[model samples]
Target: MARADHWSDTEIALTVADYMKMFTLELAGQRYNKSAHRRALLKLLNGRSDAAVELKHQNISAVLRDLNCFWIPGYKPRSNYQEALATYVEDWINSHSDFDRVSQAAVKQPAFVPTGVEFSTLLVETPKPSTTIQEEHPPYSPNRAASKRDYVAQEARNSALGSAGELLILEYEEYRLRSAGERTLANRIEHVAQSKGDGLGYDILSFETSGQERFIEVKTTAFAKETPFYASRNEVSFSADFQDQFHIYRLFEFRKSPKLFSLAGAISDHCQMDPVNFICRLR
Candidate 1:
């Protein structure tokens, strides 16, 4: 065993990297729920915070999972990172989900893959399973289906009052994606959603002038006046909990042409955010 004091910074970072990969595997369903996983991690790392433990291990994993990643949760829960990441990579292109197109998109265009010291050490403890795994095909799969069905779909469905309410939302994504890719806007307004490895919710991201990062949970609706969108128990709690870093991006004028006006900071940071459904209106 490498003595604690003797572990070089690179080695230590690698160790944390390994832990992150394992955790991502766990999120992916890799199956190492050591009876005392968190405790064991703390002991192993000599006492690091849970978030730090999570970040250190799988920073990219967290990002992919948090915002809409290649893979979304699917019919069968992910058992390991490889399978989970594969699901995202494949995008359940083969599964019967709302975002078959999106899933297939990821499969065709693979994004992040682990590398160098991070890659070798992380794979060390991962178990190779014997059971034959079932994955979705090229354009439709469980991961994509589950993601839309489980999380974002219902809200979208409920808010889709008519054709106009509908077209704007889908178009808005295209609009944002196109806009985000612009060389000018890319640096200033980041839209990449960090994956929610632990299911903490939010869909988009923005950076503020204060050198602070803001997580924007976008809500789009065709409701005539201000519309209210449903948030998960986790989403609401996360906003209320992280009073400083979170904000709500209300996309109104969605039917005509999508327009966004943000309610920056916690539900209360600006004014009282009624405990009722999160309403989409101007500042």
Candidate 2:
């Protein structure tokens, strides 16, 4: 097996296309064989071993992550990818306007929750602490404007998907409590944002097994796990005041099968808190 320092334009394009195919299938809830895809991809790249092809796939995942786009979860994005790969991905995304259109279409349809169905047990990863201090205010797109566009277009404008995601969480919380024989607690679960209002700073009011209250703020997107989300000053301050009870449930790939990761305590402790907008007073 010969190793190349960099992938050719054709090779990168092929890998990106293959990845998109897998992504679309996965989003549609269709099953696919990763090994079979690798074997098939090998035939397209001359003298590239199974391992090399797999690494390239991981590289593609890294590029996607950098662009704030979703990568295949199985790939586990590896970094130090070729710069050209980023360009290739940007081009692919720019060409595919239908990608966003399709995702938006899915969002418009109501979220499907079957009656008497057991929601999948949620497995959440703890937010890792940052090693270095981040900039006070970082530009939305320091380099790749295309990537920035992808992030903003999907996350900000997709309101239906966001509402559906909150509904999913609300049901999950209620179902979880009921399953534990805490029917009273389940009954008490409140959709604060809907029933009360969005000014409450959190969406759902849930409870712990021991009957402790939980303040949950859900952020949902159809994009990948690494995509950035907007948080209001009110939400941040509320999290700070109620650090023990506040939680941010980030739902990624919401249009597909939604999976969540949680950040507890103050929001600033978990994320690089940057102020994107501010109110100005003209006296």
Candidate 3:
């Protein structure tokens, strides 16, 4: 089977449509088999190999990430995608009105505290910095779908989802203390953000096994682990101030199988900071 240097427009369209179908199913809480979808897509993709098709899906994920739109978790965003990929992605979103509606509702939807998770096994490694050097994809245009609605940021600000995630960690922190034979400390755990209001920089206040203070800021998302989250200057500053005590519990896939990774010390130390919002002053 011969392969072309670039996927033709029709092939890209078919692949994007297939990916979106699975994405919609995932977001709607309906069941869809990824392998089955892949097999079905392979038939229409112009002699593209299995690996080639998978890479294209990942490239599409990268495009969606740039647009601040949610992508399928199974396909992590692979950078250096073809420029045509971005244009086709934009076309898909522009043509599909229901895509925006469904994604918006998914993020705004309320959440409940996740239960039955093995806290011990829930912690996973944080994502490492990308090593890619050359930047191929263009910067987000003002006309992009993400500029219209940032689904990732919306998920970040969903109070119900935020609270559910914070509470989940609050319980886990208490459980951790008690399991470590610090029942007294467990009883002292406080959801500071809930008790004292939101400006404290951190959400939950717990203690380490040795009774040391642990200040946690929890950021939850219903999407994949690599999904970007929003944070305030106050929270970043607070983490730097209390580096020893500060911890960020990033909970992802909250509505489904919930898991998290802990980032300790300053937030700036772990991830690149982007300024999204600004306050204006009259001169």
What does candidate 3's lDDT look like per residue over 212-233, in tens digits? Answer: 9999999999999999888899
**Candidate 2 per-residue lDDT over residues 1-283, each given as its tens digit:** 5466577778878888888778766655578988888888888976787777778877777676656566676675666566677677777776777655554454344554334433664545754554436433322232644555444445555666667778888888888899899999999999999999887889999998899999999988765665668888899999999999999999876655567888888998878765656799999
Best-to-worst ranking by lDDT: 3, 2, 1
What does the lDDT read for residue 262 in candidate 2? Answer: 86
Screening candidate 2 with a backbone cut-off below 3 angstroms (N, C-alpha, C), the clashing residue pairs are: 70-224
Q: Against the true structure, what is each candidate's TM-score? A: 0.31, 0.76, 0.95
* Model 1 ranges off by over 4 Å: 1-155, 158-185, 188-198, 268-283
By summed lDDT, the worst window of 10 consecutive residues in model 2 runs over 133-142
Candidate 3, residue 47: Cα displacement in angstroms equals 1.6
lDDT winner, 1 or 3: 3
Q: Which candidate is the best by TM-score?
A: 3
Minimal lDDT window, size 10, model 1 = 117-126
